[model samples]
Target: MEISNMDPPTRAGAVETTPLLEGDGKRSVQAVDVVPMKFRDMPVAAESIRKAFEDDPLMEYFDAADTAPFPVSRRKLIDMVDWMGAMHQERMLTVEGGMSLMKYGPPGNQTNLPSVAFLRDSLGRLRPEECAKRWKEFGAKARELVSAAFGEKVADMMEIQVLATDPDAQGRGYASALVKYVLRQGDADGRDVWLLTTSAYGFYEHFGFVTVRSGKVGEDNPAWDGEPITLRIMHRTARASLAQASSEPKSPVMYTV
Candidate 1:
């Protein structure tokens, strides 16, 4: 779906804003507007996504100090997110407190290897070979699970690549707005929406996504401690409207990971 021209529902020619409240049960700040992300918004949007996932399990695995050569710093992750926004700006939507990047069609070559190699060269300490190997392994595993769960229909779906709300903005509904905006586009285009998430399973459930497969990653790394992070693949079939989907009960068809 082409979402560049699509605007979230708004009021009075201005993007609708959600109110920010204080700890004392009173309004503290003005509502922030949700809009399509612009080139100028890239840095802020990237930072927001990075901050939102700073403590995420998957990120922690990649950032582990003992994971020699493959470990990535926060700065590198931020740069990667910034690059992603640059590559797919048309599908990136942002508000002051949040951002979401969605992609339509098959999950083909989503990243430019040459660009990433350039980035690795520029960033000197980023061990390109090891990082590439780790990413390749992870990608292959993820694709294997997804293909097993969805079969050939995986190519027809829309993907929620990244959805994040700044930590302070958690209760303000920015994430929900971002998610719903993409979901509306998916529904309009007759595409099911799917995503891989290490957390927020319950959060997405409210929007009609149900966990179709679940598996542990990072278990192969001997340097990793504790239980391997569990990744869940969530899917939401196309529906006429978000309201209609929420009003009806759903029984998800599950696939073992």
Candidate 2:
């Protein structure tokens, strides 16, 4: 996405962005605030973003495919940080990025070919617990940071990388706070809230995020394709303040895998 014309960065006028410094003096859960993550700042966010997906159990299955072979891994994910970070430089473009491109993607599973079989063949040689344990910290931190930054966009566009809360800060309303914030943004922008969820489907539906069957909804979204995992896409209900009005038939059955 390309954007031209922006408010020049200045002292008081600039959006003061600091990755929400997590942890209090005790190195325990801390209170937090949300802020816009800039384009230049995405490398920082990307580092955290990569970690978030890495820690995910389902994502590991996807990553085995992502990092496995010679081809799919080579092209699409290459230089993603730079590609995405550049868009974040603009406030407007980043919202779309935050929704579609950044918040939830790059699942490890890319098996349209033989990678799944390969992953099954290799599972016996390694220990799943030991392997997945290694990246937990980075992944956990990534979740918190990106969620804070995405702030209000996580509820849209199905799958996207996003941070929710610090490991120590869960259950203190950070995730709920963040979700509500994103939903409010959707309402403000007059756009439907979307999310591709594995862990939080029921949670989001509680907030009126109704699920759509891929065949009836968005086929263009890989997250909604439910390739390796059952990727559930939820959007604002017609009753939601952020519900989108479209002329196209809006049923999930209209989607293409």
Candidate 3:
């Protein structure tokens, strides 16, 4: 697909093109560019993210207690995702099929980030009370796990906060392209990268993230009948800077956060 200026502006001259694949696993004639997201992309990007995670275990767990109609629930979820997208739009990147949300702490951290209590309150207004409670608990546990896994370094690493691709757009290499794009940034800055995921373990492993810890969430919850979700904390250590790598002899080095 041709790059569309209708979406929004991207980082100056930082676009990367990747082929779109056909059902038969062959490359299509068209290609898509992965670009940095801007405020104008919020509506479409939020919809994509909401649809992408519509059936996710953790998301389902959050909405388990909702009794609203499907459309209502979907709209609420979209609104919640949009709020998050807006809050971190500057740190987001997107392609035709997927988007990645990132957060940099310490040296490169954004100023005046929202607090946990503020986020929870906002979520409560957008979703069911029970759902908000579950989110609060889950968020706390995730923060604890990340802190334990990375210690002080956690405050200085690049975090892949949300990565999603529309269901209809899967298996077309969109997600891979986004991951590689972030990995390049990490390498360029010589900064470690990490994320928490309940699925896609093998997929992320391909990009050099190793599971530093795993934990169960939503255990014995009244709203959930399914087994507890297994959340893994994956880390990719910073690679040599692009300039440093170019000057040194080439050698295989597994990238880990």
Candidate 4:
């Protein structure tokens, strides 16, 4: 993906941006707000993710499946995000007018599932029987890969499941801010953060995440053609200390407020 022009930084406590200021006629300046959102924000979050992941490898792979018409890939992704948000509440963050990030802790941390009504609505008019076979095939392969990568202690780690920005808001700094917040949360809690990405491997590396393992995703599956797509699993180790000394203040990574 191509990188777009970024918005300029602003004062920390301001929620609204200053009047539009043009720069070189190529870009403009505006303040963006990044905050943790509540459950009521899922629909907007889901839409943002669906739009961002429209061209994503994983979503495209699913869309190419034989049962694609019966079960829409984007809809499934939106529902998955909703279910994950329900499982991991406060960990989900939304950037005002820009992007959203959803993460999940260990299985033990998930106290409940999304409601049946919500799930039904997410699936829309599609029948479960039509998609069951493909779902099982995808789930089994993904689970096996994850299990092989993390082993028995997977329950103790954090997973960055979703990080998406509205296409219209891509030029802004929303992605960077959301990433900083989640990484700090993981660091403060002293838990390793793991994620799987087919693209954006370099983007994550800028913030200290490193690849742990990589493998083919669509190999031997009818959903794909020719060579299989590569999927990378990355991990970031937890920091022993979350703070810096006043005398040795680090360069600002992102706006906190």
- The TM-score between candidate 1 and the true structure equals 0.72
Which regions of candidate 3 deviate over 4 angstroms? 1-32, 68-89, 97-107, 110-120, 241-257
Report the C-alpha lDDT of model 1 over 128-222, residue by residue, as the tens digit. 45444544455555666676667777666777765666565566767666677778878898889887777677667767888898777777867
- List the lowest-lDDT window of 10 residues for candidate 2: 7-16
lDDT pick, better of 1 and 4: 1
For candidate 3, lDDT tens digit of each residue in 1-257? Answer: 01110111110011112234577944443354777665555666556666666666776676676554573446545444443533564565677623432222223442323453355345455556676667666766666666667676665677665576666666666766666677788887877888777666656665567778777778867767888876677887778753443344432222222
State each model's C-alpha RMSD to the native: 8.3, 15.4, 9.2, 11.0
Candidate 2 overall lDDT versus native: 0.35
Leading candidate by lDDT: 1
> Model 1 segments beyond 4 Å from truth?
1-32, 65-89, 97-125, 128-134, 251-254
Q: Stretches of candidate 4 above 4 Å error?
A: 1-32, 66-88, 110-135, 241-257
144-253 per-residue lDDT for model 4 (tens digits): 55566677656667666657776766657566566566677677777777766666675666556666666665676664574565666677777754333112322322
Give the Å error, residue 257, model 4. 42
Question: What's model 2's lDDT at 216?
Answer: 19
- What are the per-residue Cα lDDT tens digits for candidate 2 across 1-257? 00111111000000111222236611123443444445554343333334334444345443443333442223223323334432333221122122211232211211112442333334322324432342232233333432433344543322222433323333444444345455665556554544444445545544565555322112233433344333444566333343233222333321223
TM-score ranking from best candidate downward: 1, 3, 4, 2
lDDT comparison, 2 vs 3, better candidate:
3
